[model samples]
Target: MKDHTGKPVYFDEEFREISLMLLKAKTRWQIDQLKQYADEAIIFIDEPILSALGSSSYLGVSETETARLLKELIDVIKNEGGISGIHCCGNADWPMAIKCGPDIINFDAYDYAGTLALYPEEFRGFLEKGGYLAWGIVPTSEAIAGENPESIRKRFEQGVEKLSLHIPKDLILSNIMLTPSCGTGTRTVEETIKVFQLLMRLKEEYA
Candidate 1:
């Protein structure tokens, strides 16, 4: 993935797009623009395609190269004295994310906690290196139907139990941040507020 993002986009076997390398220069240029309006201390890179890393359509893509591309963007945030966090929001390659050495890895832990549970060693290494986990444990969809702060906390406990097998419970809890499964792109304003409310309550309960 080099920075020259041009005219048309390309796709891989599963029909996922792997086109766009995210060059270091473009990252620096773009982040410099964002710094004017947002806090530059915690610049997050949202790369949905990171989830398509090893998919059929992306077979030609080398994992090492992909990590390099990710590191390029991360280095930009770091150079700016910012914490670089990447959000995939899917059950993608966790090890790849860790190898890139991001300060935080955000994922849809609501449904994919088990997916991460499979990579205990890598997960531990990432945490040990001071990498934090923004566990998206709150559901943003209709699955939120019967859930409240209390119920979601229980769900979180069950999920964290899997990760705690390889890492300590206190360590996992200390480095965790809660988030919704994904953005409420189509949710009503009231529903969106409810997500935030649940998050607040969960924070209090856990705190």
Candidate 2:
């Protein structure tokens, strides 16, 4: 939707057209997911640019407006009885995503978890309201080669502790899901396989 015109639609520029097209296409995608998954699928709306919310590139766009745009897309998934997960794996304006009311807030917990800890009150409110947290604990970078299950698990523990400042650990854990720090499209096949295995082993250990 951002490239509906064969060129990028700058958020600081005229983005209303791109926004509308995205909303329509997103709603259609949700409808298709419901038809295919029949309520069992958690439809993810991937908008990586959202991480740029507070940057100079998006200076013309207000945080409130960003939340409104996200809500417009997220509501499509929620209305269909599907869990809506919004991911911005980079250090983003966490409060904006939280304000959008996604069932899950997926962030780069491996590196930028502390950025989220800054919003203890808002995150506590989100968690207290039964929102889920998709902690991207496993490394997706070349560091994946050096990381093992124990190290990854320790990172998760530290992140959860930072996040659990105002919320109960049990509540946070109950709603948590582990994932890579970002998508594995850029990773090697063998590396991706190892990433999965490491996390699975960690899960069994915790289980």
Which model scores highest in TM-score? Answer: 2
RMSD vs true structure, all candidates: 4.7, 2.7
Clashing pairs in 1: 1-21, 2-21, 3-23, 12-57, 13-57
Local accuracy of candidate 2 as per-residue lDDT tens digits, 1-207: 356566545453457756666776867665776677464568777778887876888677677766777787787778766678888878787777888889998888899988877887888888889898888888889999999978988888998888778678898888888878888989999999988998798788767
| Model 1 agreement with the true structure over 1-207: per-residue lDDT tens digits | 233454223324222223334355566776778778777666567877778877897787778767876777787778866788888878788888888778988988888888877888898888877889998888888787768878888888899998888789888888988888788887788788888888888888888
**Which ranges in model 2 have alpha carbons more than 4 Å from their true place?**
1-7, 10-15, 30-38
TM-score of each: 0.82, 0.86
